[model samples]
Target chain A: MSLASAPPVRARAVLPGFRLTFGTTLLYLTVIVLIPIIALVIEGAGIGPARLWDIVSAPRTRAALRITITAAAVATVINAVYGLLMAWVLVRYRFPGRGLLDALMDIPFALPTAVAGLSLTALYSANGWFGAVLAPMGIQVVYTLGGIILAMSFTSIPFVVRAVQPVLEKLDPALEEAASSLGASGWTTFRRVIFPAIMPAWLGGVTTSFARSLGEFGAVVFIAGNLPFKTEIASLLAYIRLEEYDYEGAAAVALVLMVLALVLLFLSNLVQIRAARYGAVTA
Target chain B: MTRALLIGLAVVTTAIFVVVPLVYIFVQALGAGWSAYAANIMHPLTLHAIWMTTLVAVIVVPVTVAFGIGAAWLLSKFQFRGRGLLITLIELPFSISPIIAGICYLLLYGRQGWLGGFLARHDLDVLFALPGIVMVTMFVTTPFVVREVLPLMQAQGSDQEQAAVTLGASGWQLFRRVTLPNIRWALLYGAVLATARAVGEYGGVAIVSGSIRGKTNTLPLHVELLFNDLNAAGAFAAATVLTMIALVVLVAKTVLEHRR
Candidate 1:
């Protein structure tokens, strides 16, 4: 299979629909995805660097970005630890309701974000189920930073669990046995052997989770107070700008988010590539 | 003891984080009793939102499935220049936020957008209408079917396809007989995912839909409207419909995963 060369000239084409499929794919992608994204870039570029900096550097913009990043980081941390635990348990153990638990992991992906947001907000509001329990302790979740992180974590949890599960399942038991035979404790074996095996995939998942959390709007918006400088997230900020007809402002903020998401996604792809290489070596 | 402890922790965390909220949706939806819940679902605006959402899914699922098949076939069967870039571009919408996608469409089709003037002159109303909502939903859910199908096609390879071609099969016959059978489960799985996403898409649609009460509101949008209006019971009732769709998608996914 030639990677960069023209299609090989054959007396008979082995498979059909090359031209038709390729043309349709290209046309659909250009109209549906490429052109719209290009429009965003062009709009952002049309704003001169000086004004772009002004928009980004403005207090409200900076606050929103900071809150988004901070909450996402917090959420990613929660997912990283919790996801690893879930993946390890799901892959390595059997218990009653295990399949049900496994299927439930995807609720975040399957459930609409707006519904997730509403449900979460309800469950954490002062009079709500969990919120009622925490309110007396002065641990308010809704309309606070905690709610933002909770919403982010809830929406992005599957990324980590799903990412790490396959890697953990594929891990060779012999490596752990070897570590144990060498007098390593169970914890040591996990830290030295199992940890390294799943590290790449875990990192990839965590990065992707962070990226998803950063742009999470529907899930976070309902829970977040949306107070301009307090709990407002960057994506919501962009929407607010749009609502105010500040298209340039919206584009500038969105460009920042788009770049962040793309860079993280690129990083994730790189990590997955590395993980694939690592898997090849181990297998 | 250690095994039990670990298992217990995992189960509890999953319960709190995953299961509780799901149950909460239904509970809240029914908190006002079955009669009230039925009334909320039967509300004219809510009914219209459901219809609108279903209409969008009916249109989006088939179109996206076709695109997915075309793109998967092209990428998996043929190797060429910029294939990697093309694949990346195909998955671009996954990384970008849906709200940003809305903005992208708005920038292209809004009244003051790039083609906004052109569209206005032509009397084309794309933004704040069905077209705009459909476009953004398409953008957000485009990657699902392709992502699901491409890897399976690549792994299965074109050997069977080659055999069919040598058997004097026409393009349509080859795909319908060989490729379609091999990928039908995955294609359906992708379609299921796309439907879930299309039905539930909120942010991008929210940006473009203008939230016209009975005209443009999708179910998810309607839920938000109800929630913001402090009608928790009404919001959850509408959300219950979306939740049911999500549950169905989950079941489809599990079945497809087993078959695949």
Candidate 2:
């Protein structure tokens, strides 16, 4: 029987310095990133299933996880609806300050998380400007679950906005025209045509925003009020564990957060791929 | 009317959530006027943190760029064994939390760490020192450059370089003349993003730095420390520096996008 032939090896581009550069990249990656992550996984696994269960199932740990998951879900839901609207506005409508608004979208990406937290806290605090307005309406945002979601949304707004904007911009105008010709109302057209076209990308963006909110520390810590079993989050709790010299406990907490982030990243990729599949011709 | 209301909602949400906080930082920093703001920034500890932050950037940016460029060259230019695995491995850092990265290093270098015994025997410090801070910063920002440059190079493919090589150009000549110029914008864009990150990183540096004032404290850490001490003025002033960096990054990004 004839065996199947293997493919030929690809040629090296930087043949002159290939070995040197490749070696340096591998060594640097191993030392700077790979080794430490491996160390964390090792330490986490060494805790064994029983210890891991005990640490995470504890009242405090469970509370932080619950709060973190709930807040992130709320934030993602807010982003899902709001980001769609924002992207539609930016792409479909021509406004006076459109370019300026577009530039402001990147602010969240550039601004340091700690700064975002501080600014949001200032704006939402009782004596702060927005708080003053909202308080008269009997709404208190700061030092509450509302404040946590606000900060997360502030830091992660760009994700959903930027993700959906391009898709909306590149949308086939012919489809909208055809719908109008078919006597579809504006709302009906949006419901049947626009929403379905952009849903996967929109979902992908929200998933990313959700994942980001989970690992958020600087912004959340400042505004979350840090009251255990109430405002405290998983990342902050993990930080506290580290501070207490409970390394194993900290690693356990972090492993759960890492898993959550990885899951979201996986979901984001799947959603993006689904988006691609849905619009093979248009996308 | 629906469009107006929706746009109004978007505008209001951004104004409340995005714009207000940005303006609030400078407003608070200058709450005591300009002179006080300057003094807060010029405080010795603040000075040290700024310098420390700059030092970390100077060291980390180059190393990260080298990693980015090197990795870009290796994984893209040549098809190699385990290339897919290598890419996933390179990208692993982005999925990790900065705090977790610090924890990993701490477990590897802290007083009771794996290397702790050897370091103590050698009288060398790793955790809670400048070295530890640099390491963590490098780890956090490692993926930025690769993420930026690799796609461009791959899309361009090896056709140009193969032509140059066939024309009797040396490897350096091929890279310097053909590759570098082609990838310059993407490379600089990556480096700029990395610089912003290296300067702004807080959580990773905080855990490894031990928060020793004027010694290992970074700019972001200094801002948090000042706030915690009720030194609101000092905190705001220092935050101004970081915000300005963020502003510059935004401007640079705009310019880059316009060029593209």
- The complex in candidate 1 yields a DockQ of 0.62
Range of the 10 consecutive residues with the lowest summed lDDT in candidate 1 chain A: A1-10
Chain B TM-score of candidate 2 stands at: 0.97
Task: Report the C-alpha lDDT of model 2 over B205-257, residue by residue, as the tens digit.
Answer: 87889989989999888888887888978988998999999999988987877
State in Å the error of residue B56, model 2: 1.2
Candidate 1 Cα RMSD after full superposition onto the native fold (Å): 2.5
Task: Please provide, for model 1 over B1-260, each residue's C-alpha lDDT reduced to its tens digit, 9 standing for 90 to 100.
Answer: 77788889999998899889999999999997999999999999999999999999999999999999999888888767777778788888889999999989988998889899999999988887899899899999888888888777877877888888888999999999998999999999999999999999998998998999999899999999999999999999999999999999999999999998
The sequence of per-residue lDDT tens digits that candidate 1 reaches over residues A166-224 is 87887888888889999999899888889988898799889989999998999898999
Q: Each candidate's TM vs. the true structure?
A: 0.97, 0.95
Model 2 lDDT, full chain set = 0.84
What are the Cα lDDT values of the candidates? 0.90, 0.84
Candidate 1 lDDT at A183 equals: 100
Write one digit per residue (lDDT tens) for candidate 2, span A1-283. Answer: 0000112225563355678777998899889988888888888889999999999999999999999889988988888787887898898888888887888988877888887887777777888888889999999888899999988877788778888888888888888899999999999999999888877778878888898888888888878889999999988888899899999999999899888888877777677766655662253
Determine the backbone clash count of candidate 2: 0
Compute the lDDT of residue A272 as modeled in candidate 1: 71
